[model samples]
Target chain A: MSARRIVALSGGVGGAKLADGLMRVLPQDTLTVVVNTGDDFRHLGLHISPDIDTVLYTLCGLANPETGWGRRNETWQFMQALASLGGETWFRLGDADLAMHIERTRRLDSGQKLSSIVADCAHRLGIRAEVLPMTDAPVRTRVDTTEGRLDFQDYFVRRQCAPVVSGLRYDGAARAEPVHSAVAAIRSAAAILICPSNPYLSIAPMLAVPGLRQALRDAEAPVIAVSPLINGAAVKGPTAKIMAELGLPVCAPEIARHYGDLIDGFVLDERDAALADQIDIPVCLADTLMKDIDDRERVARASLAFAERLRAEMIA
Target chain B: MSARRIVALSGGVGGAKLADGLMRVLPQDTLTVVVNTGDDFRHLGLHISPDIDTVLYTLCGLANPETGWGRRNETWQFMQALASLGGETWFRLGDADLAMHIERTRRLDSGQKLSSIVADCAHRLGIRAEVLPMTDAPVRTRVDTTEGRLDFQDYFVRRQCAPVVSGLRYDGAARAEPVHSAVAAIRSAAAILICPSNPYLSIAPMLAVPGLRQALRDAEAPVIAVSPLINGAAVKGPTAKIMAELGLPVCAPEIARHYGDLIDGFVLDERDAALADQIDIPVCLADTLMKDIDDRERVARASLAFAERLRAEMIA
Candidate 1:
C-alpha cells in the first residue's frame, strides 16, 4: 500500500485539478499523470501542448487561478507585441507560458522525445510525481463542425467554440505509438483513475493511442472514473454543450457509459445521486465539484476508496 | 532637393541614432538605410538580426532609452520562465522584443525574403524612411578573437567583448548579393553618409558584401563618413577596445584611414580637429558625440552639409 503506483489519465484544467489533488495525497512520486497531447498544435512555429502545460503548471502551483491554464501573474506583452508585428494572434500565448512551447520546441528540434521533456520539466518544477504525455507522436484532435472541419484551437480559441461539434477525430492517432512509460505505468498500477476531464476531448485521445486501451483493459488494478459533469453540466469548458451537440445525454450515467467495460467503478457527483442506478458500473456518490484544494483532496480520497472497494468485491 | 533620396550605411545604436536624425531632418520617405545583417544568428531556432532590429526600433521611436536596445518597458517573464525550464539564457531576449524574432522566424520559414520582411515591418511600424538589410543572403560576422573564433552575438553579448579581437570575417559575404533595393538606392543616391558605428564589427560587414563596396567606389555621388571615435574613444560599444587590440591608434584619423579610398569626405569630431589634416579625404570638424536627439540632428546636419560641399566641389 505504501508503494502503491496511482496512475491517472488527464486533459487540461479539470483533470489537472484532480491530478494535483492526487499528487498531494498520494505517496511522493507514486502518481503518474498521463496527459493528453491531442490538444497540441504548432502556433507561430512553436509546438504548444495545452493540456500538458496545464498539468505541469497545476502540479507546480504556477497555474493561473482565474483561467486554470497558463502561469499565474503572466504578462501579455508578448501577445501585444506579436500582434503589432502582424504575427498569428488567434491563439494567445502569455509571456510566462510561452517558455514551455519555446523550450519544448527547442528540445524537439534537437531530437528529444516529448515524454522526456515533460519528465524533465516536472522534475525541474519541483513536482515529485511523474507527468507523462500520452504519446510522443503528433495526434491532433480535429473537430467536425457544422461550420466545416476546423483544427482544435481554431474551434476552441479562434471561433470560441461557437460551431457545433458534430464529431471528433484524432488525426494521427491510428499510427501514434503510446509512450512506453505511460503503458508501463498502467500495467503496474495499484489503481487507475480517469480524471474529471472532458470525455470526448481529454480522455479519448489517450484511449486512441495504439496499445494503450489494450494495456488498460488487461491491468490487474481496479479502474475508476470521476465524472466530469455535476448535475447536467460541466464546471469548465464546452463539455456539456458538445455532449448535447453530439446527441448524447449530458449526465454522469452517459459519461460512465462512454468509458464502458474499461472502468470497473464510477464516482458521480452528489447532485446526480438519483441517477447512480442508471450506470451499469459499480458507482459511488461524492461531491465531484472541486472548487478548492480541500474539495479536490476529498474527491480524490473518495475515488481511491471506491477503487479499493471494487477491488475487494472482485477478489470475493 | 525635395526628393533628396539620401542613403545611409548603418549598424546598431550609434548608427540608428544618426539614421533617426536623418529621418527627422530630411524629407519624408527620402532616406534609405542599408543595415548590416552579419550580426544575425539563429538562437533557439529564431532568426535574430540584432542590428536590423536596433535600427527599426530606433526609427520607430520604440527603442529603449536606458539600454539603447530592445523595447521600452519590456518584460523579462519569458527569460525567467525559460531559465526555470533549463533553456539558454545567455542571450537576454525581453518579452516584447521576442515578437520580432518569432515573427521574423515564422516569415523566414514560409519563404519570405529578409528584405521584404523588413519593408513590411517598417511600414507597419509607421516608418516613413526605408530600412533595408545590406544583403538577403546569410552573411554571419565571425570574430577572430584571442580566445578563439566566435559568432557575433557570442562575442558581443555572451562574452561581453572580453575576448581580444585579432581580426573579423563575414562568412558567406563573398557570394552574398546586396539587396536589390539597397543597391538601387546607392546607385540613384544624392549622397552617401556612413554612420558612427564600430568600423570592424558593424560597417565592415556591409562593405564585405560583393557589389556594395564596389558600388560605393563607383557612385557618382560623394561618399562621406562620420567618425565613430571622439576624443580617442567611442561613445558606446567596443570600438576603442577592439581598435587597441587590433594594433591601431584609437583616433578619428585611424577610422578615416580604415575607409581609405571608399570615402570622399570625413566628419572628424571637434576634439580631433588636429587629426583632420592627417586624413587624405576632405574633412569637416564637428561635435560627433550624440547624447540626445538634438546632438544626433546636429551631427547628421553637419555630415549632410559636408556631403553637399563635397558634391558642389566635384561638380565644379
Candidate 2:
C-alpha cells in the first residue's frame, strides 16, 4: 500500500502533543493538522487564537515545555507593565507570545484571512506539516454556566474554569464555513485521527460547524479517536468536570459514544483496557498518556496502527 | 499677583522634559499640557501616539532617562518575537510601553475621544496635572521629502529622518477642531509656554489645525516659546537638519521667525545670548540644556519668568 496521509483534528496542549508526534512519525507533508479556533477571542484589541497558537508553537518546537502553552522562556514584562497601567491583566499574554497576536491582528485588520495568516506563520516557523485552522471565520466557544454565558477565555483563563458548565455553544460555528484546506485534507485522507483533547470543549466546536461533522461522517478514511479520558478522569483541562456537569459518564466508552459512528476505531489507555469491551466500535488498548515526546510518538503509532486495522477489517 | 496658571503646547522628548519640569514647579491643577497628536498612527493595528505617549511617560515619571522616550526598565522581547515572525520592527514597541498603545487603541476603537483617553490614562498613572491632546480629531503629520511624501513615522522612525524634508503637511488639520480642554486652557491661560520641541515637525502640526493658531493668537496670555535650537544645532532629533533642508537659518532667531507673530517672548540658550539682538520678541537667555530634572525645572522657571516679563510689557 502507498504511504497514508493523515488528517488530525486537534485543540491545544494535549492535542498539540499528539499532532507533534504524528508529524514526527508521518512522512513530511503527509500529516495535516486542523486546529480548533473556537477558543479564539479578541483581547487588548488584538486577535488571540489560543488553540491555533498552541498547535503552531507545539509543532514549531517553541511551545513552553512546562505549561504546554505559550513560548518557552517567555517573559511576563508585557503583563507586568499592563498591570501597572491598570489595564486588564487577567488573561496573561507573554512578551514572546504577544507577537503572534499583534501580527495576526494586523493581518486580520488588513483583510487577510486567518487561515492564510496561519499558513504564512507556519511556513515562517519552518514547520513541514500543513497546519490549518478549522475555519477562517470567527467561531467562539461560549460556555453556558450557572453564572450565565461566559466567553471561552473568560471561562477558562479569567474565571479559571470555576463556573460549572451547564452547556456549550459555538457562537459563530453554524455560519462559519470549514476552511477549504481542511475539507480537502479530510476528503483525501487515508485516516482521520481525533486527538485526545477536551471532546466537548475542543472537538465539539469543530463538529458544530454546519457541514464539518457531515464531512467527517462521509470521509472514505477510517476515523479513529484517542480517548481524552484514561479511566474516569481527564488528564488535563475541564473535560471531566464538564462531562460530569453535563451528566455524562466520564470514561472511554462515553468518549466513544460521544463520537458515535463517526469514528470507526477508538484508542483507550492500557489502564482502562478492561472498559474496551463496553465500547461499541473497534478499540485498541495502549499507554495513551503522553508524558513526553517518546510517549507521544508511541501513542501516535498505536493510533495509526489501530486505524490501519479498522481499514483492513472494512476491506475484508 | 495671583498664582499664574500656565498652558504648554508640546511635542515629544524635549517638549515632554520641559512639561515635566513645569509640572514639578507649578502648583496642582495650575498647568495644562497640550500635546501634538499629528505623529499618531495606527501601527500593527494599535494606535501609536508618539508625542502623546512621550508626554504622558515623562509627566508621570515613567519615561526612560537614557532614551528620553518610552518607559524605563523596558524589555525588547516583544520586538524580538515580532522580528522572528517577520512583523514590522522598524518602529520598536517596548514591552512595557506597549501597554499604553494597546490600551489607547482599545479605548479609541470603542469610540472614545483621544482627549478623554489621555485624561483617563494620566489619572490612572497618578499624574495630577492635566494632559491633553491638541485635538480630538485625527491629524496625521506627513513629510514632503526629496524622496516624495511619507507618513510621519515612516519618515521619522523607519527612515531615521534621513529623507531631506522639503516641506511638511498636517493631513487632516484643516478640518480638525482643537480639543475643548486645550482651547479652554489657552483661552483662560495666564501664559502659554511653547516647549522646546521641533518648530517645524512638532509645533507646526498643532498650528496647522484651523482654529488652533487663531486661538493662540487671540489668547490674552503672552505666548512664549523656548528655542529648540542653540549654536545652530538641535539638542536631539532631526530639528536642525530639517531646518537646514528647508533653507531656514539654524539658529534661535530662525526659531522665533518660525513662530512669527504668535509669540510675545522667546527663551534662548545662554550660549545663544549674542544672537538675542536679532530676535524681534523679548528674549531670555538661560541654560536650556535639560540634562536632568533640575535643568528642566530651571528652564521651565526661566520660561515662566520671561512670560511674566512679556505680560508686564503688554500692560505698560
DockQ of every candidate structure: 0.87, 0.80
Residue A105 in model 2: shift from native, Å? 1.0
Candidate 2 local lDDT, A1-316, one digit each (tens): 2466899999999999999999988888899999999999888889999899999999999999888679999999878877877789888899889999999999998999999999999999999889999999889999999999999999999898999999999999999999998998999998999999999889999999877887898899999999888778888898988989999987889999989888899999999989989998888999999888999999988998888888888889
Q: After superposition, how far is residue B106 of candidate 1 from its true place, in Å?
A: 0.8
Model 1: clashing residue pairs?
none
Q: Summarize candidate 1's per-residue lDDT along A279-308 as a digit string, tens digits.
A: 987889998888899988888889888888
List the candidate 2 regions with Cα displacement exceeding 4 Å: none
Best prediction by DockQ: 1
lDDT string for model 2 (B12-94, tens) is: 99999999999988888888999999999988988999999999989888898888678898899999988888999988899
TM-score of candidate 2 relative to the true fold: 0.97
Worst 10 residues of 2 chain B by lDDT: B1-10
Model 2 local distance difference test score: 0.90
Tell me how far the alpha carbon of residue B47 in candidate 1 is from the true structure, in angstroms, after superposition. 1.0
Tell me each candidate's TM-score: 0.99, 0.97
